[model samples]
Target: MKTRTKSEMNKIRDIAEDYYIRLGKKGRDIADMLGVTEQTIIAWKKGRDGERTWDERKRDMELTPLKIRELILQEAHKTLSGQKSELDADRLAKLMAAYDRLSKKTNPRTVMDVFMMFDNWMTDEEPDLVVKFTEYHRRFLFYIIERES
Candidate 1:
């Protein structure tokens, strides 16, 4: 296995912790999947053996998911704008998967509703058409966000 930097390790830990919360995965299961010891997973979770204080670790954990999304979008924009020959497809895909997994609760309706509130945003005359559009968006998002393994 390749060695991971502290930042990378923390990101994985955050994802695993979130998985544990959302899917009822045990720390041992997460550790086994990641090829880490249960003790290490516990340490990371408890902040008992980590270099940073609990608050700092918590803050980083909280921001990691958002950061992953930002990085993926930024890199995609860079690629699309011809600023780069090619983006890291593997990294970008992993980042997107991670973001989608962690952001499963993100409501597509909230966004569509906000846009609909604006005048002339969605000019569909039929109410059923609007409902169908909203449902399509919601299903589209769900299709992209892979369930936790």
Candidate 2:
């Protein structure tokens, strides 16, 4: 494809807006169709501010939730540098295991299955079960979820 001119970018923005209103597709779909990445679509969608050049176009986008997760890990690594605390150790090990499993393309432990299991377990609320689980995270997750629902 030829390098996008201002008019071409405006056209892309209009089409992208239409795609969003029609089906709420992420910019990624438009990018894929246009033979570019989602990021380029995002930038082009943010038109130049009274200028004709790409430099005036939007950049330095917000951190997505996934990227925010990485930032959180980085902050945690920096802050948890002490000899150790139980909370720090457990979280650290869990993160390391996740990173290793994922980077190696191994069968990473799935959280959705665990979510489902918790979901099923929470559906039953026998008085005995509630009292037994009162001090546990399962109780808190279930309580909060039920309240939100």
**TM-score: which candidate is best?**
1
Q: Against the true structure, what is every candidate's RMSD? A: 16.1, 16.0
> Which residue segments of model 2 deviate by more than 4 Å?
44-149
Model 2, 28-144: lDDT tens per residue? 887777666788766765645764423222122233335645755665666666533434656766866666554553121133345546646775845466445445645655565
lDDT tens digits by residue: candidate 1, 7-121: 9887887777665544457789989887778887777666555466444645665565567677789898887777873557677777678788768765443454464563234
Candidate 1 residues lying further than 4 Å off, grouped into runs, are 47-149
Task: At residue 14, give the lDDT of candidate 1.
Answer: 74
**Per-candidate TM vs. native?**
0.33, 0.28
Please report how far candidate 1 places residue 101 from its true position, in Å: 28
